[model samples]
Target: MTRCALQAGALYESTSITYTPECLDRLRKAFPGDFDDVDEAMRSFDPASAPAEMLSVLRSFTPARAALPGAAAYFHAKALEAIAALSMRPGPAAPKARREDRELVEQAEAVMSARLSERLTAESIAGELFVSRSRLCEAFRRVRGSGVAETLRKERMDAACRLLSAGGAHIADVARAVGYARSSSFDEAFRREFGCFPAQWRQDAV
Candidate 1:
């Protein structure tokens, strides 16, 4: 796998993975319909960005197998998943800036999803990408049509809804899980986002 070339201060990390021919053959067999798409992905390879979750799986893998019984199979399955993920089609191509900006937006969203319980800030996320907060904000606005802060809240709210729908946890716990420091703040945001409080939403979901 080759990373796509991206703009300065792009959020997605750049890395490449290589698979043996056997691995590639397995991928073709696993996802026959997406075989052509995988070829296209390789042909149009970019060095700037890759699918983040898939790339992470690729990176996390160690060539050395675990001692456990199913370890070999597990690693093989993961390799297959990684390749299939790369094979999946991305959205329509945009201008350079737009494409890079969209990547930043996705990286920020992924951070929000992963760090929902932490008091993370856009500045912190931008710092990780070596980009200034203002630049990151500009990119987010251009790509997602929302400021980073709003996007963060939207992510947290979406997470909150999923937790609520799952039907467990106290309201306060749910609030914290989605990055709100206080239940009152969570309730207010949830009302604004969904036109009802979290408790009510849970009730309605049931």
Candidate 2:
């Protein structure tokens, strides 16, 4: 029973629990090869690891057993149920980036800061570093927990607010300086992001 349990657990870990040499040998004595492989595949299988064909085979196994009606059917059903449950449960999450990836992210952020007024895109940044956009986005999200566009918008807004509070530059100038092409666009973006117009924000800051 302990051996069965351990073998069952091992089978559960796999996407498809195909017959081991021992299990195959035992099944062969009672059943033909037609169902032996299918039986092994259905029991203690990990749905993820099992091919679609294996799942279909497993599903058919119970009905096939009903045709003959044996101990194999009982064991097969129990193992199949266990494997199905395992498959339904979520898999382990991916591990996060290491410290080296974090450092690369910081370097990317510095690049962003230096080009605040320039139109920056994730692809452009990733291209500059010879990395894929997905990898860059993943690293940035790991460290900052925000997308590249959102981070850039926040930085631009922060700069705009600082300029507004300083009260030396005209709103239009501040907007242009912070990468906004027009005052109206800047005002709209500011309101959308900061919940107030740039002038209103300036007044509140005062």
RMSD (Å) of each candidate, 1 decimal = 16.6, 20.0
Q: Please report, as a residue range, the 10-residue window in candidate 2 with the lowest summed lDDT.
A: 31-40
Query: What residue pairs clash in candidate 1, if any at all?
Result: 1-17, 3-46, 3-47, 4-46, 4-47, 4-48, 5-46, 5-47, 5-48
Candidate 2's displacement at residue 65, Å, is 57
Per-candidate local distance difference test: 0.67, 0.61
Candidate 2: clashing pairs of residues: 15-46, 15-49, 15-50
TM-scores, one per candidate: 0.51, 0.51
Off by over 4 Å in 2: 1-95
Q: Write the per-residue lDDT of candidate 2 for residues 24-76, one digit (tens) a residue.
A: 44433332111222332334445446445445655554444656757576657
- Give the alpha carbon lDDT tens digit for every residue of 1-206 in model 1: 44357889868643345776776655434322224234435656664576786867767665455666788778777776676566553634433457788888788778777887876666677887778877776786578654565667667777888888888699999987876667877786678668998899899899
| Candidate 1 residue-pair clash tally | 9
Rate residue 141 of model 1 by lDDT. Answer: 55
